[model samples]
Structure formats: C-alpha cells, structure tokens
Target: MIKEQGEGKSRYMPGLDGLRAISVLAVIAYHMNVSWAPGGLLGVAVFFTLSGYLITDQLVAQWQTAKRIDFAGFWMRRIRRLMPAMFVMLAVVGAWLLLFDPERLASLQGDFVSVSLYFNNWWLIFHQVSYFESFGPPSPLGHLWSIAIEEQFYLIWPILLTVLLRFTKQRGKLMMFILLGAAASTVAMAMIYVPGSDPSRVYYGTDTRAFALLIGAALAVAWPSRSLSAAISDKSRLVFDILGGAGLLAIVWLIWKTNEYDSLLYNGGLALFSVLTAVVTAVLAHPASRVAKAMGCRPLRWIGVRSYSLYLWHFPVIILMNPSGIADDVHAGRALVQIALSLLLAALSWTCIEEPIRRGFRSPFREKIQGWSPFQYRNKRAVSALALMLFLISGYSSLNADRPADPSPAIIDTSSNGQEGTTLPVTDPGIPAVVIPEAPIPMEPQPKSEESSKPATNAGITAIGDSVLLDAAPHLEKLLPGIMIDGKVGRQMYQALDVVDQLKAEGKLGDRIVIELGTNGAFSSKQLRELLSSLQDARKIVLINTRVPRKWQDTVNSTLEEVANEYANTEIMDWYSASKNKQTYFADDGVHLKREGAESYAFLLSKTLQGG
Candidate 1:
C-alpha cells in the first residue's frame, strides 16, 4: 500500500487502479463482440469485488479513527462523484435520440427513469430482458445496472457497518456475519439460476449478486499490513505466490474458454471467479508482492484513473457510432473509430467536467466558456456550433419522416381448426407496408418407400426443441406424415431429457429422433453425451444446429458437430451454414424463421432424413 497523501486518506494503491483498467477494458472488448474475450463480461465481478474492498476499507478506517461514521457525508460524496457524469451521458444520449431516433424515446424514457431511481436491474427483470441476449440495437444506458448495484451497496452498507461496529468490537464475529450473508446470497443464486435458459432473473437480482461484493468485504477485513513485521514471511510469501498465480491463470482460462451461455457459469462459475479475483486482490494489496509492482506500471495506472469515465461513455459511443447493430459483424475501421472517439470523450469529460465538478469549480455552464485551455476552448466552441447544426438537420429529418414504429418480436401462429401448418411474421419499425405471406397449403401425400410405408408410423419419428423448432413444426408434419414435434417456448435440453424418457416409457420413443435444443442457450458436452445415451436405441438421430446471433451460437454448433462425428447413429443438420446468407428468412431477432425459412428448413430436414 502506497501511503500517498490525497484528501487526508492514508491508503493509496495504484495497482488496484490497474485492475480497474483491466476490468473496464475486458467489458468494452466483450461489448465490441471481440472473439478473443468470450467471458469479458466477468469484468463486472472484478469491479464488484474492488468496490466491496475499497468501500469496506474506508468504513473501517473511519470507524477506527473517528469512532463514528458520517453517513450523510459519505452518501453525498458518492452522489457527487457518480451522478454528474451519469447525467451528462444521459443528456447527450437523450438529445441524440430526440433528434435522430425518437422511436426509441419511449423505451429510453423508461430506462432513464429506472436508472435515475437506481432500480434499472429490477426494471429489466420485470421486462424479462436478458443482458446476454441481443435482440435489437444495444441500449446506451444498459451498463447502468452495475452502477446501480454499487450505489445500492453504498447507500445501505455504511449504516449496517456502523451498527455492527457499535455492537461488537470483535472483528471475527463481523467477518463471520459477512460470510453468512455471502453464503445465503450464493445459495439464492444457485436456486434461481436455470442452466441453458435466460439467466436474467438471477443475473440481475441484487440478492443473487451480493456474494461478489461480500467476498471483497471479507478480504478487506483481513487485509495485511505493509509494515516490515507484517511483511509476508518466506513460507507465507510462497503461499501467496502460488494462490496469486493460480487465480490469475484461472481468470485468463475463463476469459478464453467460457461465455454467457455456458451452464457451468450459473452452477458456480461466477462465485468461483470472484473468489479467485479476491485472492489476486490480496496479493496486489501487499506492497512487497512482485505482481503488485508489475501491475502498477504507469500506463495501467493512467487508464485506471480514468476508468469510470471510460466505462460511462464507451457503450453509448459504440451504440451511436455503429450503423449496424451491436450483434452484427463489426467493421474493423468503424470499431477503431469508435474506440478512439470513446477514449477522447473520456479524456475530455475527465478534464472538463469531472475534475472541475469535484474541485468545486464554478457552475459547469460558466466553465464551458473559461475553464478549458485556450486550444481546447476554441475547439469546444467549434464543436458546439457543428453539433447545433447537425441537431437541427436531424430534427427536421425526424419530423418529416413517417411516425416511428414500435418493433415487435416475431411469434409463431398455428392456423385454427387443428391444421398442421405454421406461419411466422417478421416485423420491423420501418417498412410498415411489408406484408408477410400466409402459410403454404399442406403437401400432398408423397410416395412412400417400403420402410416409410410401414403401419403404426406414428411411432417412427419425434422432434423436440424450443421455439425455433415450434416455427418449423407444422411444415415438418406436413412434409413427413405423422411426425411428432414437442416444442415449447424457452425449452432447455435438460427438460427435453425428461420428455424423451417419458416417451420411451410409453413405448413411443420413435425409431428416429431430432433434437434442436441449443437455440435458447448452451449445454455442456457432458449433457449432450447423456442426452445421446438416452436416444441410443433409435436407429438414426438428428441434431439441428443453431444460428442465433448470441455468444452461445458457436459453442452450441461446435458441440453438436463434435458429438455427431463421434456417434454412428447421429448426423448434424448444418442449419448455421444453410441460414448464413438467408438473412431475409429470419426475423429481426435473427433466430426464428419466416415462412420461406421454415419451408427451406423443413425441406433440408426431409432430405437429411432420407439420407440425402
């Protein structure tokens, strides 16, 4: 710990700032859809752990010195530090929306309200929105949820810590209490989390995520001293070195190997990541640790100092600069421009807005004119004029354009009167006059081979999947007589295992099986192997791959291909390849099918079933 004097605080750790830099960069890379950082979103857990440690350390120091906590002052400090930059970003985004895309205003308005109130996570949960699921354009303010969690902790924790300090002088008891809370939160997460499904309920819940924060607080309670006597002994140093090395390796492994879709993530992955990060944090907190010195390099410290502003501005900049949606393939040139602009904005915000506000400068309205360097002041004036001109043009275009349309998700609608046909409509805000064709008439009975013509053919074939399978059910039934499709919205493969077992017990496990379960989320290779064993009695098995534009797409597809190659009874449908160029066949969500897509999909399956 470097005891640099800053505003009367004795403890300063530049290496911690380097950690912040790493965390925010990982998150930015993940949001950019960079292939190398699949688990980059875990950066949020790092931030959470850091927050817990820093905030707890401060509270404990205040208690030890002043023997009392200044709750009101602490709250005001946090609000002053965070809210000003947040409001600036929101105002800029709101103006951009009003000028260029008023259609998003309604949703943005709701998001702004929730964020301002520090309840954005609950609002997202209420709307059943999953952070990992990219269905449309990315929301600029989507990252605010983490800030909300931090603020929530800031609001409630000081009071709780004060009470604990007043009640018990024993640090051990307090640590025990915190451990209990962590245990409860972890259990709650494990209970609510469902593998291979939308994880919004657990991911966004404060109760479920509090464990990461608690882990940090526990470490703060046990933080080692920098004094020579308290310096790590040779044996203890070896232990720290091993734990630190293992923790760093684990984090790097997870970043490369895991993604949001992995089931292990829900089971225990996040908590494990937090624990490992805590171990690294302990090593970094000690000044004698060689790893700490390496992480405290000048560049990492500089980025760490500006990390907050970078995080606040990067996502909005990415969204605004991206003409194509976030989930689409990114142009390298555009991505580079986005990164450069985001960094520039962060630097400007740091110098012009954040520092001045923190230093109690005159109103920002006045500083806009006088506080900047002469070069910056002139550039700011020119930029302001240009912005005004563009805003007017955008406003005129928005007004003269047709009223904005609300985008609706595509849904399957089976025809009435017990028909075996499905039609899907793909809706977009633009092209209001776009018409979707009705379902194709059922296919006439095709000539059957000796094997296909067998009686009691209802027992010959069955298909199980999620809504993607539901979209193709009617077409499949029409093309292949007496085919059974058991598809439910949001169905997971684990649930499908039970369905298959029930079918087998009823003596209805068909001679052939088609499983299309990975669209919603990813399953482990072990799960896939178990599912295949359940269907081993079938003469032929079909695994339909997914083309959903989510992090899990490749994992699901690759797993299917690998398992299929190893099993003589199985083959993959290659839907990802078939659907690659057929963009018009998909809805705006880029997963479910339109009518023509369903027809193409059914035809492919029909041919594959016939050994084509």
Candidate 2:
C-alpha cells in the first residue's frame, strides 16, 4: 500500500480516465447505431466497475485511517459531489420537454422527479422502460438510470462494509465472497431466466447489473501491497499491456456484432472480459508501462474527466434532433453534426455548470457550513423539497394518464347467422362463392344462473407493426366501437411478434389481427415470412400496404406487395390507392400515422372486416 502523508489528498490512478473515455465513447456510438457497435452499452458496465472500485477504496481508506467512519460526513460529501450536477441536468431536461413535445411531457416530468430523488432505476423498472424503445428517445438524463443504480449500491454497500469491518476486522476475504456470490447469482439468473424473459425487465433489473459493480469493489478491497505490485517485472507488464489491448478491442468488436436480442449474453461476456482487463491493468499500473502512459494521454483523459457531462448531453441531442418520424435513419453527415454539437454542449455544461457547483461544495465556506449540526445545515429542507417534487410529479402522471383502449372489439357479421356454408373473404374478389356459410351453431343458452359466465362482448384487436402501427391505435378504437384495439409497436417485426405472444397469453388477443408492419422489416423477406407465421392463429389478418410520404413510396409499396403475396390469410388494405400518390396518413414524424390518416385507416379496416 502506498502511504499518504496528508489527511485529505489521495494518489490519482493513471489510465482510469482514459478507460472511462473509451467506455463513454462506445456508449455514444452504440446508441447512435447498435448495428455499427453491437456492444456499445457495455460502457455502462465498465463505468459501474470503475465507480465501485473508486468509491469502495475511498470508504475503506477513511475507515482504516480514522478508526471510525463518520457516516454523516461521508453522506454529506456524497450528496455534495453527486446531487448538484444531477439536479441541474434534470432541470434542463424538464425545460426541454415543456418546450418541445407536450404529449411526452408527463413522462419526462415523472422521470425528472425520480432521477432527482435517486429512484430513477426503480421507476424505470416498474414501468418496464427500455432506453431503445420508440417512446421517442428518452430525456438527456436517461443516462442517470445507471447513476441511480450506483447510488443505490453505495447506500447498501457501505453499511454492509462498516458492519463487517466492525465485527471481523478483515474486509478483503468478506468482499471476495460477496463478489463471487453476486457474480455467480447474476450469471445463473441470466442463463436461466433472462433468455426467455421480457427484454425490458432483463435490461433494467438491478440484480442483473450488480455483478459488474461487485467485481470492481472486490478488486479495490483486495488490492495487493506495493511489494507485490513491484514484483511484476517488465516482461509481465508488457504481456499484461498486450492482453489489455486485446481485451479492449474484443469488447468493441463484440458490441458491433451483437443486437438487442443478444444483450444478456453480450453483457455477461463483456463484464467478465472487462473485469479481467481491469485486473491486468491494475497489475501493470507502474510508470514505466507504455500502455498506462498511453491510456493517460492528455486529450483522452480530458474527455474521460468530463465523461459524466458527455453521457448526460448526448442522448437528448440525438432524441430532440431526430427527424420527425424516422426511428433509425443512418444519415452519417447529420449524425456527425449532432456529435459535434453534443461535444460542444457537454464542454459548456462541464465548465460552466458542473465544475462550478462541484468546486463551490468543496470550498471553505461550504465546509464550515457543512460542519454545523445537521438541522442547522438545512439538508432536511432540501430532502423535503425533493420529496414534494416527487409527489407532485407522481400525481401529475397519474392524473394525465392516457388509458389504453379496450383490447377486445365486438365482431360484426350481419350477412351470416346460423347458416351452413359461407364464402370466406379472400384476396381474389373474382372467385366469390355462391353460398354464404353459416356462423358456428350458437351454444345452447344455459339458464341465466348467477354463476354463468357472461358472453364476450369485445374480443381485443392486436395491431402489430412498426411505429406507425402504434400511432393508429386511438383512431382504430374510435372507428371500431365496443372493440378493444391495442398496438404492439416496435422497430422490428420480431419485437412485435414477442408482444403478440404476450398479449395472447394475457387473453388480450382479439378475433381480428390487424397488421400494419413493413416499414422497417420490409427490406427482409425472412422477417416478413416470420411475421406471417406468427399471425397464423388469427381468424382474420389484415395487411396494410405501405404508403409513402414521398421518395420511399415505390420501395415501401414493392415490399408490401411481396409480403401480401406470401400469406393466404392476408388482405392488403390499399393505403397506396387511398393516398392518391401523396402522403396522407403519416404525420411529420414520417413513420407515425397522422390523426386524419389514422381515422381513414380505421374506417378502411372496419369496412374490410365488415365486408368479410
């Protein structure tokens, strides 16, 4: 162990900041395009590790030197370090929501309150939030979800450590056991449950994420003495440097090759690889190691130093500047411009907002005030205000609820009652049957006993499609009265299928399955075939041929026609014909249906079902 002569000052580790820079950049790039960088989100795993190591190290050192941990002082320092910048960022994000999108303003308000109160992760988990979902990219503070996780860990880990130290006087072995147990449990859980579970739950659960942080904490607690560190010769250091580089490169490569479907496996692998790299890097932390010096480069270290601000700023910029309706447009030039803007904004926030507040909290005046009794310092007042804000936000969200429409709709067929044979609706109108088949014999009406089950008045409609299908739900429900209509919206058809299966299991699958997918999945014949296969159970499946705003009409129409031909149950709703060569149904957010268009679509859909 390196001895410190001073009371407050601590030795700075080399290359840690550079590693942070790499992680943050990977996250930004991954969010920008998961296709380009599959495992980019692993940056958060790296961050958790770094945070665990540093925070544990600080707390353990303080306990060792002082012989007693000053819990109040320790908590105060944490609040001062984390809260001010976080609150300021939340305030900014809140202001942005108010000015930009009023429809999503309620959710933003709720998220802001949760983030400020250090419960964003819990809120997100309960709500089943996914950062990549099409609820229009989340606020800039979406990144704060990880921060919430870390803070929550800090709350528990310290108390556990303090207790362990008080009793055992040996921290290293205890930490190792805890870390090993956590890692084993996490891996086991992921293997057994995550593969077959809801992606949202798997992505956001705290237990699923704890292993990454525990690994770092364990390393910090079990750090070897300087004598052991010195025993690592130049050859060993060189070998470690090579291994670390390979590990880092492998992580980046894996990210580019993976997708959201593979998140559990990718994250598990990355965490293990990262822990190994961290261990190797720690062993080679000497001044003579070129890898350490490279990782401590001036520019990279500078970016790493302000990584928190960059992480906070990047998502909001990408979300807010997104084109009206396109979810994933690969406009390299536009993205580059956005990236530049994000960097500028991050720099300004880091210098003008975060640094000033952080420095202020560390100043002599603030220290003197902090030394006062807890009540005199007014920390309770701040806590009370935060509580009130959270209450207000929750109340607001509850009051402004956008209740989902009934999932079932009454099926109307006036032409057929108890008939024998009926001509089923088919794509080829010329081959109309001469006889109309009778509806299935009505079950004998049992005496209306009190225990008798009521007839289903509304069988729910499942609208499976891209983002546009989501936007059409309200209009659809309005047009098809007494029937429940809900949308399973996603960027990929496979995601839509997943939701469809869930709805079926929940008994929300209606008599009619309406499909308006194809915008994104149209390019892939395999996806279209898969979607058709998934909808095989539906009594009636309606396919809306793609309509274009302008340039992509030909491409979208071609894809739609191909899909229509491949399925027997499919009937193409002529959206292309209805639009009359102009974009009618879509909103400025090109992928979502406009109100007028959705109403038109609902009318057409109702007519098609009624005619059948």
lDDT string for model 1 (469-561, tens) is 778877887678777777665566666788788777977577899898777666778778888988887899999999987677788888888
Model 1 quality (TM-score): 0.82
The worst-scoring run of ten residues by lDDT in candidate 1 lies at 412-421
Candidate 2's residue-wise lDDT over 302-379, tens digit each?
Answer: 777778878877776665555432225455875775677667555555554555465653543223321111222345
Please provide TM-scores, in order, for all candidate models, with all chains considered together: 0.82, 0.62
For candidate 2, the 10 contiguous residues with the lowest summed lDDT are: 409-418
Look at candidate 1 and give me any clashing residue pairs.
Answer: none
Regions of candidate 2 where Cα sits further than 4 Å from its true position: 1-9, 96-107, 168-172, 184-198, 224-231, 263-267, 270-274, 280-288, 323-327, 330-334, 356-589, 592-612
Best by TM-score: 1
The best candidate by lDDT is 1
